[model samples]
Target: MHIELKYGNRKLQGEIPFDAQLLQPCIPPPAENPALQVHRALDRPLAVAPFEQIFSAGERVVIVTSDITRYTGSEIYLPILVERLNACGIADTDISILIALGIHRPQTEAEHRKILGPLFGRIKVFDHACDDPAQLVELGETSAGIPVAVNRRVVETDRVIVTGTVGFHYFAGFGGGRKGLVPGVAARKTCMASHFSVFNKAPQTGKHPQATAGVLDDNPVHHNLLEAARMVRCDLLINTVLSPQKEILGVYAGELEAAHLAACEQVQDLYQPRTERVDLAIISSGGEPKDINLIQAQKALDYGCRAVREGGTIVLLAACRDGFGHEHFYPWFDYQDLAQFEAALRENYQINGQTAHSLLSKARRFRVIMVSEFDAEITARMGMEKARDLQQAIDMAHANLSSMPKTLVIPDGGLVLPHQFVKVKTFADPA
Candidate 1:
């Protein structure tokens, strides 16, 4: 079968077995008018008062949103949100937009323009400086002892609205919701502390099993983030669910936790696909910014590997144009031993280190052949084999399998989660 997968800004074509199962999220058609959906969602919010009613006139309001890395349909929603606030007697001067950069770098002027769309220049926009102590306000700690320092602008605002797109996160269950607060505008230490929950309590125990994707119940990472987010004074949340093509499918607005939960359920129903385990899985880290760096691209690897059996072969297409998302990320690979890596991570916890650990762990379980911008040596250092292209990677994977293997091809690995279907026998079923 001829298959085309996204590789950075371009597409790579390859041939797979015709019988291979093509996995993709069961996305509904894009909304005809996404802007209208945004308006309607704000008009009738879930579990909270209307957007206008929640805020009084002349109040200082801040809309916290994801940076350029994770597009939240902000261009479509921010203007409507500003218009609503304006109608509520809030002047443009009293309102500001804070980009939840977290530990990421500040957005460039072009990037900011893209994120804010029409609201650019008209409304003041500031990037959250996670490392700047002067910009952060400590708001106590979570039950799990994670410090809850957030951007002073968000904490001091009269009304805070968190906005982002909802998607299946590799860990912390799902993204969006309180994530816009905890790691989004949180301090460097707060972001690290909240993310450190992904690891087990014991040193050599590895990552907490419950910290896997598409889960929320008892997920230590999610719990830590939730606790930290609740420490802030967030008045509303407006999260969107996008189609695989990045069109708005649904807009969820209202109370923080409740609204985000509603969006998470929709993401589960749309993005999680069920299939039997396959011997070979070919996956792509969707395109452009999704494959912008190894840090972000690893999410597709985490989610796509679920469809492959242990010791199976995986052909991962991650452009990684920006290289390791962070400078500290690649160095973690120096500890080739998982146990040693865990110990090092425990000694000085870093979010990038955790991601590197996760990447190395997957490489150990599966023969990962990556088609990316990284050099062969870099790929080898990370425990992955580098291929010049998708076809070469496919040939390498096929050569490793002893026989003609069952295969699964996932075009949008970053957005889709594949689950193995468990066979159950009932009394009425044939034995």
Candidate 2:
């Protein structure tokens, strides 16, 4: 019996005993319908807390949410959250929406309209400006020593409602809880500190992050986020977990850490991918996000790294309109090859960013192919191959595959990663 294995453009067909197997049937771990418990998750919030306790009749409350873009695919969750807020008697007019722009570019009017819809026209809607570098209001520092500066509107508002997704994160353990505040509404320097801050200490990463495995309460990063939210007087934390097809899995609201972690249990079950051997992996951003930023783009490296071979290829399919997130990250990934480039940046910390440096420290080794309108020629110079089209790249890889290469394919790159679905293995066979 012979088994075919793929490593990027090459494939290896190895002869095995009849008892040995190659092709494996993969059934993504099925997640229980948390939606049935959705009402349960919120039962305490709605049933216990009175409307005026969280908000008042005439007070202003801003609902901070990520605008509909390629990342997070937050359109569905945004409205569901607002409807919940409206039911609390927080009139739509008193509600203002501030997209946690973070380091990503500003959201356009068309995107804003589509994100909000026609239901609540009276609410004021705006996006956080991280590029301004001017209006930043630094509140204080976190226990981790990361400085926190949130948008003035966010702090000035009588109350704040954070809306985001909960999933596995490379740094800061996980996403959703305090994330919307730091990079979402925090200033440029603050966003830089919050995001790049992960580089200060090496992250614990392997096939799985033990620290990131469970929900937010136990995660220190989540705790740090809670502190940041407390500084700005965050009243409510609303997070959602969506299925592969973008269906609502569950919603966890109220207390930050506990709620975020509860959501992660569900998100990890769905968004996590499952594949053991992958020489070449194809991850698409699902073409849902309007534009892919380096911050959101980092998911590919986090969850997808587990499936790749020791020396393999990782093709990230995203539209990174903003290019390398921070000026500091360019020199990190910008090299003749990741090896030489990473060495230079690590040896000379003068050029690398905080969190970007953190990522380089963990990666085993893999090449990234930027396959969107991200100034392809420029990235090509830095060793990252730029593909004109997704199919074209795949065709080229197929053209170069070995006689039998074990290949793994992940359709929606944004939501899935190699590590999420499969356990990583040591690659010693070069055949």
TM-score of each: 0.96, 0.73
Predicted candidate 1 versus true structure: per-residue lDDT over 1-431, tens digit per residue: 68889999899998764357778766668666998999888989999988778998999999999998897789999999999899999999999999999898888999999999999999999999999989999888777777788899987779999999889888888999999998999999999989988988977988899998999999999999988898998899999998878899999999889999999999989988777788888999998778989999999999988888999999999998778878889999999999889999999999999999999999999999999999999999999999999999988998878566888888899899887774212112332
TM-score of 1: 0.96
Q: Point out the worst 10-residue segment of candidate 1 by lDDT.
A: 422-431
Per-residue CA lDDT of model 2 for 190-295, tens digit only, reads 6555443222244322212333423344445455666776677667777777654555667777765566666777666555545676666665544444224555
lDDT of 2 at 137: 77
Give the CA lDDT, 0 to 100, for residue 165 in model 2: 76
Model 2 compared with the native: what TM-score?
A: 0.73
Predicted model with the maximum lDDT? 1
* Candidate 1, position 314, lDDT: 94
